[model samples]
Structure formats: structure tokens, C-alpha cells
Target chain A: MTDARDGAGTAAPPSAREAYRDLLPALMRADDRLYCLDSDTGLFDRAAFAGVPDRYLNLGIAEHNLMGTAAGLAASGKIPFVTTMATFATTRALEAVKIDIAYPALPVRIVATHGGLAAGHLGPTHHALEDLAIMRMLPGFTVVVPGDARQAGEAVRQSVGLPGPVYIRLGRSATPDLDARAAGTGPSAGEPFEIGRAQWLRPPGDVALIAGGPHPVLAALRAADLLAAHGVRAAVLNLHTLRPLDADAVVAAAAGTAGVVTVEEHWRSGGLGGAVAETLAERAPARVARIGMPAAFAERVGGQDDLLGWYGITSGAIVAAALNLISGTPGGGTDDPDLSRV
Target chain B: MAGRAPGAPGDPPAADLPAVAHRVREHIVGMCAGPEGGHLGGSMSLVEILTVLYFAVMRIDPRRPAAPDRDILVLSKGHGAICLYAVLAERGFFPVAELAGYARPGGRLMGHPVRAVPGVEMPTGSLGHGLALTNGFALARRDRRCFTVLGDGELQEGSVWEAAMASAALGLGNLTAVVDRNALQITGPTEDAIGLEPLADRWRAFGWTVREVDGHDLGALHRALTQAETDGAPEAGRAGRERPVVVIARTVKGRGLPSVEGKVRGHYARLSERQAERSLAVLRARRRRAAP
Candidate 1:
């Protein structure tokens, strides 16, 4: 299902296709949202899930219907992901997510795509920035944001076997290249990913960089390079699972390091950063800086990079923030993790 | 009991009727006073309906709640859980005395129904969520039957309407919704909060076979539930032609205790010990009079 990219640079990055393609079969085989009364908006285009081997129902634009139906399917022993735009999943189907899936602890994985500003030019209504905050308020819901194709693939496969409710945020924008050699998913890539453990990208360092979903990985790369320039040696950690958070690993990393920097594309409240703070505040209290979306909705409309820059969610902003924290520049105001002003 | 023609409009034997209603009311009063707080009015309204479903109509085995073919029941407005808990207990889902734990800390019988409770099909308290669940259960096992009870006030939520539309579209004949229209909510009477006068028409428009019943009457409830089975008799034997059914049950807010029965403020009014004693006396008198 990989879309062959020709010389025209307008094609979506190959890495994103690679990530989505891996879960295509599994999602096709199981996702009941694919077979709802409506048709699936081809936003997550890869495999035409209909006519797939299993009952892969696509409930085309009805996010609420997808969520409610998925709950029923889960109650009946089927693993269903109520797939749709992140905005619709968060806004329209929020009641279903809160009541049907999370509160009841139904094991329905809300595999939301086009998270954050990934739905370029679709305007602010389609952009999903506060979904994490809204979802985290739920008691039993686990929020998972895969950093790359490998992580996304692993999350989908592993989530099928795990218990409880999960909200998986994916992207419509281009994804970063996967460290093919490091990820180790040649032909054996179909194996399930571990759900709650954070993948350590670098050896132990003075500053610990905790990242989740997609934007944080970009921040990790830049922050690592920036930290290297100052001899501050930073360790990058991919926190794919947001709830039932990798508390032990984060505590260990924060305790071992001088400071911690949490990066994400979600609002500062109830997202990866808040989760990390909750962990450290309980297990290992340390100086933690956060980089993520603000609480206010974006009035401007633009492409992925433009939206990220406007929200101070870009890798450069994260790198600068991380360096300032590491160098003790004492960021002008309260280091309260949820500093994003929308 | 094995295979009576469902929904044939008529009164059943009154001998068994008063006994079932008495048992249900006794359970409700005892449980509410024990807990000191409950959706007493709501539960009281649903007593006769629950009695009818558990004792007469629903094809359920108390020992095997998860039986492949067992009829399912979902309490959408789950705050009205006392009636369910009491009925399930009377039917032997668990020890009836456990009703004393209602709303207590660390109690299984919380203010709402939870799936953890052996016979409860789904965890509920949030309004307007049960119908969708009923739709799912029915659609999943098209071969089985399911029933869901919703409060009139709970129908104010848009989700219930969404579920109503979906179930009708799916042609889920095996699913039935029994709306306890007691005319009241936590605030005031339901019509004052949000008009549901066109409620029956709404369900019919949504493609359900609508039946209005005197919810407090055991005979009417049994008849309506039976009538639901033969709604579309031509395709009665067909696999999936059974359309969803909505039984709009007109009930008093509190059916047994005359002091609270039909009182708009009884939805959450705490029953005084004296009031509880009085209600128990009424139930006892009724039992004695109906003993023969």
C-alpha cells in the first residue's frame, strides 16, 4: 500500500506511509469503524478496508456513531478503533469517548488521525490540540502517541492484546524517517509493540528529554544536537504511551539526570508533560520543563510546519527551551509545566 | 411461562400480579431506607416494569447471566438501579440482603449499576448511553433478544436520539426500549425541563413499533412486551426483520407509597424513618389483603 513517490517533491514523506501501511492489515482486519453505515473519509488512505478479510466497517464521517458502535463491538469481544479526524473524535464524539469507552473502561482504541495541525488548510476546526487534555481527564483511558512509524505500528499491534481503553493519536502530515537499523523491523516488523515502556534513544546523559507522539521526536533530535554543542549531553526518551505512563522509567531518568524536558504537540494540560510531572512529583521530583501546545485555539490556518511554529511547538523552539533550562537561564516566568497560553 | 403469545393485549391473573408488585415495592423501600439516599422515585416507577420483565417475559437464566442466548437488559438511566438490583436479587442473581449496601462506600451496589454486578450488562449512570449499548448487543447477536429501560428525563440527551435513529436504521427487532415516563426529573416534571409530548411519535418516526403502557400495571407491561414480539408478524419468523420497539410506560414517580407516589419532588427526597415505616405498613397491608 506504499504510495510510490515520484520526482515531484509534493508527495507525502515515505516514512509516514511506511508507518500507516504496517497497521493497514491489522486495522483492516479488525477496525469496525470501517464498516459503519457511512463511508470512511479517505483521510487515512492506505488499504480500502472494506472487502478486507474481516468485518472492517468504515463509518464514513460520523465520529460519534463510530465511537458508540465501537463500544458495542468491544462489548461483544471485537477490538474496534473508532477512527476519524482528531478534531471530530475529540469534539463531536467526545461524549461517546467519555461515557461509552473510557468511563465504562471499554477496550475501544480511538485511532484518531490528522492530529494537531496535520490536517493542513482544513483550518483550526479540524486541528486537534486539546484532545490529550480532554482524554486524560478520563479515569481509565490510556493516551498513546507514537513517535514514528515503528512506534505507531507497534502501538496498534500491541494495543489489541492489552487491556482497557486507549486513545491513539496519529498524523496526516509527513512523519520523520524511522531509524531503520535501530527500529529493527525488516520482515519481522509485524510483531506487537510494548504498550507502556519508554524507548531509550540515547545512553544516559545529564539532561533527560522525554517526548511523545510525533512533534516530540523532532524536538528530541534538535535538543540532543543543541545539548551536545554545550557539552550538556542529553538523553532522548520516546514516551509512546501517555496513561499508565512509564512512571518508573521516567522517575529513573529524572532522578539520574540534572533536569527533564517533556515535549509534545498537545496542550500542556493533561498531555505528556502533565503525565510526566505527575510521575516525577510522586516518584522523583526534579526540574522539569515542558514544550507543547497552548490552551487557546489557533485562529490562524496553515500547513503542519507553519502551525507548529505558531504554537511554539517546533523542534527549534523545543531545543531553545531545553538549552535555557539546562543552562539555568531560569525561563523568565514560572517553570510550571503547563505554561502554554493557547 | 415457556411460550406464551407475547403482546396479546389483555389482563393477566391478578392473583400473581399483586404478589410480584408487593415484592418489588418491598425491595425498593427496604433498599432506599437502608442506603438513606437513592433515585427512590425513579426506581419506584420502574418496579412494576422490572417485575414484569424478570418474572414473566424476559427469557433469562439467573444462574447464567452471560448465556449465549440469554435475553439482555440495559438500564440506560442507571440511577434507577434499585429496582434492577432488587429484581435481580429476587430472581436470585445474588443475595437479596446485599441491597443494604446501596450507595455505601466500597459497596457493589453503588448509586449506579456496574457490569461488575453479576447480572448488570453494562456499567451505567450517565444518561442516554444505554440504548446504544442495547443496539450493539442486539445487533451483535441478531439471534438473541435485548431490552433497555430509559428515564423520560434521560431522553433529553441527544445521544439517546442518536441511538434511537441508529437502532431503527439497523432494523434491530430484538432490541426494545422501555421509557419510564414518570413526568418528573431531578429539577421538576420532565415536560417543564424539556417537552417529550411528541416522544412516542419521535420513536415511531425513527422506525420503531411504539407501544404505550401503564407502567404500574403488571398486566399491561406483560401484554406490551409480548406485543413487541409480534410487532411485524408477517416477518416474525424471518431472521432480521424484527424492528426495534419502544414501550412508552406511563408511571407514577413513586408508585407504592401514597405520600410520595406521583410527587414531583420525590426523585431524590430522603425518606424519613417514619415515612419508611408508613410505606412498609402499606406494603404489609397490601400483602395481607392479597394473601388469598
Candidate 2:
């Protein structure tokens, strides 16, 4: 019933995992019925919930029952946070997620960890590449893949208030906390974490870099800095929440900027790139590039960095895509086949 | 039409259930005689169970079905929705007029229970999910009882076992599940279709406190349910075992109207006008015999 999360020796920056472990117990105190259910993915500390053991039910390996139990708790007037790896939460328990949680509009927060290439060492079978696409198909489902652990914790805290099913995709890696600082690049970054709103780390310039998930957002910021050195002023918009998408920002970025490029660790077909492209195609058609893995299973990469590199979900890929769009040569080698019409 | 919110429902006249069930069966037969016939056998088999719960057992307020302290019921065997609808209307959850819209499009009443229907606690059509869901409801407000009626065939779903395991492990004594053990499924006899013998032992093995009862015997259903709600005292006893109850309600597929009684074809059929008249006449005869 335990995993590698309990054996961590990293002094990594306070992650969303840390924030949730610290803040969730407090939320539980505020609402007695705010129970925590895990699929035996002991990624978080159980001792942290020292006082309320009954409030925490480890559903072992049954992902379907984990979600269905959450729905039952919701129906019974308890707010339950169902946790599991992103792989099981979306695909393995899809029917439960759809019928039990989403269809009923239950107030259950799905705090899924190891999303996308974040589980890189675990290979494609563990990668939740299609989570966002699958979740978007459910009506009234709020999907958020925060840029960092801080945003993730903040999103989780905010999700408790929303009265419907909310899917919060967390990463295995605990990157530095998100800083909404005022001094950085294109746009100001100090936006409070909101469920439906998008946060911009840097403002729009010659081109805008729209990305989500922990690694991809950081990569886009790094790409923006690299684009600046090459005289291509690029902006980074952190689309933390996938559904109830910030279409207006996408449209504005398209209308104001020369071009736009999307980055994510997910497949190029239905990730942030697909969401942005679909929005832009209808609202404002513009030159765009999508930097992501092809519409296929990920390679058997050794580690997270290697997996990101193999799929071209790196800062270099984002910079290259932005530069291609900034110049007149859009749809460079970075464009996905799914984006041919876009 | 305004739904009359009456006082919390009280026990029925102990002697009147047979006649009451007879009338309820007549209503079921009339509704199924139309083009939109329902799962008549499943619903008919459950008439006494629903009658016992609504009239004598459950602490429900039809006027305010959402009362925080009221007992909740989920019909996991969704095919038998017409029977539930009939019981709910008789219990005054909605007006009798709503019965006409059963199985019709753009109406509140449907083949399966939706939250749109006032009395239904959770939407259930796909089997094996009800027990798990009801367990949550029980755990949330352990002070009240959460009951779910499931079909014998629904046990074939792994999700049923999933809920069964959780409910037992958690010792959710505030919850109870009534299995309509008619033995036959939509395809054929459940054992013939998918062997499920040793059913009682399987539930006990899963950690549930199991009980068997004559499902059509209204007095027996009333006794079993009354005993279930009295356990697991409160949240203060969370540390102790709060055993959830599962009542195996033995029944015949078609409980009355002998022409199709216990026959698989009664599962769903559009009764002809003549057949419907004869069925009503038979139920009325049973009513007269039970009345005096």
C-alpha cells in the first residue's frame, strides 16, 4: 500500500505535493466530511492525517471503486478527494469517473499525480497522455494541470469550493513553487490561482507560448527567454486549467502576436496544443506551431528528461517552434499531422 | 400540480399490505399494457418489498424528500423503475399523473432512475455500483440508514463485489442492501446464464452481515429493515465494527398474475388489453380475499 513517494531524499523546492500534504488536513478540519481516498498510491504522507484515520480510506488497487466511493460520499454529503496516479484515474476508472462523478456533478476533487511524461521512467503505459482529452469529453468537468506544485496545491484548495467534479493533474517531479512575480518579461505573473482562469508567466510579444502541466509551462518560460536572445520576443501563457479554457486570451494572443506555439508533455493531438488550435481556428485564425509527442505511444526512454527530449517537449523545441512561426515559415518540422488543417 | 408534503410516513395497517400490493400490481399491469411496456417481472416481483419499506419501514417525507435526516433508497436494479415509480407515487413523492409519462421522452419519469425524479437518491442503470454508492451515503451520515435494492444478476458485475468489499471492511452498519432474488435475468435463469450459487455465503465472505427473507412477504421485509437501521449507533462508534446488512429477498419473477408468473417472458412485455384486464381482475380478487 506504499510507493516511492515515502522514500524521497530530495530537498526539492516545496512541491504541490508538500502543499497538499500540509493544507489538505487543514481543509479536512474545516469540513469533517472532506475525506481522502487513495488507490494505494501512497505518494503522500498518511501520518500527516494523524487525527483523522477514518477520514482516509485507501481503496487499494480498485480505481473504479475509488471513484464510485467518492461519488457515494458526495451523494451522502461528504466531500471526498480521490487520489491516484494519473494513469489509473483517467483510463482505468474512466467509466466510474464519467458515470459516478461527472454525470452527477459531484463535488469530488481528483488529485491525480504522475501525469503525462512526469512518469517518464515508468514508460508510456504509465503516462497519462490522453487524460485531458478524455476529461474534456465530460460536461462540467474542470481539468487543471498546474505549472508547479504551488499552483497545484492552490488549484486543489480552490477546487474544494467548486461544486462539481474537478480533475487536478499533478506531476511526479516536485519543481520549484510557481512565483507570480511582477518583474519578469511580457506580462505580469502575480495572478491568484483560479479554477477557470489562465495565468500568464510572461506577457505576449512577437509570439506567445501557450503551455500547461508542470514541466511544459516551465519549458515554455525557458523557451521564451531563449527566443528573446534570438530577437524573437515570445510570451508564455500558463493554461493551467484545460477546460473552461481561456479562449479569449488565445484569441487575443492570436490577434495581437505574430504567431503562437503550444507546448506540453502530452500527445500533440489533444493536449494544450489541440485545445489552443481548436479555439484559434474558430475565433482567430493565425500561424501556430505545436511542440509535443507525435500521435503514438512514447518511446521506452530511461528517465524524465530523456522522455521529454525524445518527444520534443523541451525548451529547445518550444523556441524552435516559436522562431519558425515568428518568421514566415510556420508549420515547420514541429507541427503535428493532426494540425494540418489548423 | 403541488406535491403535498405530508408528515413523516408511518407504518401501514399491518393487515392491508396484500390488498395494497394488489392495487399497486394493477397499476403496474395497466402501465405496461401500453406501447411502452416496462420490466414488468422485475418490478412486480419487488411490489411487496417497496410496499413494506414505504408504508411501514422507511423514515421518509414525500413533501421534502431532501430532508437531511431521512433514510435514502437507491434502486440499483434500474430495470424495475416502474415499480419504484409506482411506490413513490403511492407514497406521494409525486402525483399519480406522472405515471402516464413512464418510459416517455421529455418527461421526468424514465426507464431508469435519474436524480430528476424526486425520490431517487442516485442515478443507477449499469449494475453493481449501487452498494458502493450507498455505502458512501451511509458513511457520510451514519446516523440515518442508506438502503439499496439490487438484482441477483447485478452481482455478476465486478463493481458489485467492489462495493461489497468496501462496505464490509468499513463495517458500514448504517447501510443495507436488498437483493431481489428472482434467479432469472434478462437472458435466462441467472445460474444458467452465469452460475451464482452459494450467494449467501459469498456475501458473508465479502464481510456483509447477510439475512434471507421472503421478499413478497410484507411483514418479513418490514422486520428485516427495522432491524438493520438500529445498528452502528453513531459516528462516536466509528472505531468499532459497523456491519452493513444485506437482505436476500427471495421472490418469483412474476409474483402474481399466474399466466406469466415466474416466467422469463414476464421480464418485459406489452400485455394485450384482454391480458391486462384479466391481470387486474385477478389482483382485485386477491384484494377482496385479503381485505376480510
**lDDT of each candidate versus the true structure:** 0.71, 0.78
Per-residue CA lDDT of model 1 for B30-83, tens digit only, reads 766764567789988998888888778887776677777788888887988888
Q: Residue B278 of candidate 2: its Cα lDDT? A: 84
| lDDT score, candidate 2, position B163 | 83
Q: Give Cα distance to truth, residue A105, candidate 1, Å.
A: 2.7
TM-score of chain B of each: 0.88, 0.90
Off by over 4 Å in 1: A1-54, A58-65, A181-193, A230-232, A332-342, B1-17, B228-242, B287-292
Clash pairs (backbone) in predicted model 2: A16-A149, A186-A203, A187-A202, A187-A203, B5-B63, B171-B242, B173-B242
List, residue by residue over A1-342, the lDDT tens digit for candidate 2: 111121122326666666676788888877786999877887657787777877988878888778888898888678899888888899988888888888889998898888887777778889888888888778989898887767777888888888788998887767755473223544546657787788777776788888887677777777777777998777778888888898987877677787888888787777788888889988889877887777767545656666666566778777777777766773544434333211
Which runs in model 2 stand beyond 4 Å of their true positions? A1-11, A180-183, A327-342, B1-15, B228-239, B272-275, B289-292
Q: Best lDDT goes to which candidate?
A: 2
Candidate 1 versus truth, CA RMSD in Å, comes to 6.2
lDDT of 2 at B181: 95
